[model samples]
Target: MKKLLTMFFTFLKIGAFTFGGGYAMIPLIEVEVVNKQHWIDKEEFLDIIVISQTFPGALAVNSSIFIGYKIGGVVGALLALAGVVVPSFFIIIIIAYFFLQFRNNLIVDLVFKGISSAVPMLILVAVISLSKSLKKELSTVLMILLTVIAISVLDIHPVLIIILSGIYGAVFLRKKVN
Candidate 1:
């Protein structure tokens, strides 16, 4: 019970404080779950991030659920899921109620603009952090380069890229089970 409450509150803090969306919350989730709380190790956290992205729902919610299930069980998953979603639910409702009044306010516009500028940097930090876990091999470098090109230059859909990458890994990058 205590652990469940702790998980709920921790995720609540994460959801409440994160200004941008799931990508921007990656660093905070990593820090809290891996570094601060020791709920999971770094590699496991990265795995959660990858799995979360592969799913349909929000990254933060998926991550929280995965982490919670790993730590406790189904009950933990529910608690963590609620924790992460509750803040966003209330915040969105409040914003919806108030945004009409502030729609034309210059200060509101400036604030959103400032947030937009920071969101990219937050995502970059997540990318850099995740990249640090990759092996410094030629295949790794090539995969990274190709993935970037597929997304930016070829304008390939990311879901398709992920599916193709998984197939590529299974076919060519499989490790022998000893």
Candidate 2:
């Protein structure tokens, strides 16, 4: 019970404080789960991140479910899911209710602008942090570049790209699972 509560509160703090959605939460989650708590190693955390990104739901929610299940089984997953979702649900509700009243306020606009500006950096930090775990192989680089081109230039569907990439990784770029 105590461990479950700890998981819940940890995720709750992460959800409450992070501003830019799942990508932004990556670093904070990494710090808490991998670096601080030592609940999982970096490699497993990265694998979970990859799996979370591949799935349909919000990355943060998916990550919480995976990590929570790892720690304390089904009950932990529910607690963690609830903890991570509760703060955002309430915050969004409050913001939706009050946004109209202060929509045009200069301070509000400035604050939003500030937050928006920081969001990109948060995402970048996540990218950089995750990239550290990626193998620095030429094939990996080429795959990344090609994927970017396929999505950006050819207007390929991301889902298709993801499926193809998964196939490619499974067939050719297989890693020795530890």
Candidate 3:
């Protein structure tokens, strides 16, 4: 009961302040879940991030659900999901109302631009943190490098890269269970 409540509130706070979506939430989630609460270790958090990205829907929502389930079962998952989504829904509604009112304000426009500029940095922070948490292995490093190149240079869709990476791992990188 207490654990479920903790999960709910923790994700609630995360969902409230985090902007620019899942990548922006990573650092905050890391601080709260790993550093403050010690709910999971750094490596485990990164692993969960990877799994969330490779799986489905929005990463932040998926992460909240995964952690919630890990801690407190189905009820926990529901509570945490509600916590994450409710804030965004209410905030978006409120903002939509105000946006129409202030759509022409120069200051509001400038503030939104400033926030847009910060998004890339937030994503870079998440990438660096996740990479640091990963084991320094040849194959892992090579895969990361290739992924970076593919996204940056080739402009490949991330979903395609993810799918192909999985297929490559299964076919070429799979090891015998002997």
Tens-digit lDDT string for candidate 3 (48-142)? 89899987699889988888887788998899899889899999899998988899999989998999899889888988887787678788889
lDDT of 1: 0.93
lDDT of 2 by residue, 1-178 (tens): 8888989999999999999889999999999999988989988999999999999999999999999999999998999899899999999999999999999999999998999899999999998988899899899899989999999999999999999999998888666442
RMSD values, in order shown: 1.1, 1.7, 1.8
The lDDT values for all models are 0.93, 0.93, 0.88
Model 1 misplaced regions, further than 4 Å: 176-178
What candidate 3 gets wrong by more than 4 Å, as runs, is 176-178
Off by more than 4 A, model 2: 174-178
Better of 2 and 3 by lDDT: 2
Q: For residue 56, give model 3's deviation from the true position in Å.
A: 2.7
| Candidate 1 per-residue C-alpha lDDT over 77-144 given as tens digits, one digit per residue, 9 for 90 to 100 | 99999999999999999999998999999999999999999999999999999989878989889999
Q: Write the number of the candidate with greater TM-score, choosing between 2 and 3.
A: 2
lDDT of candidate 2?
0.93
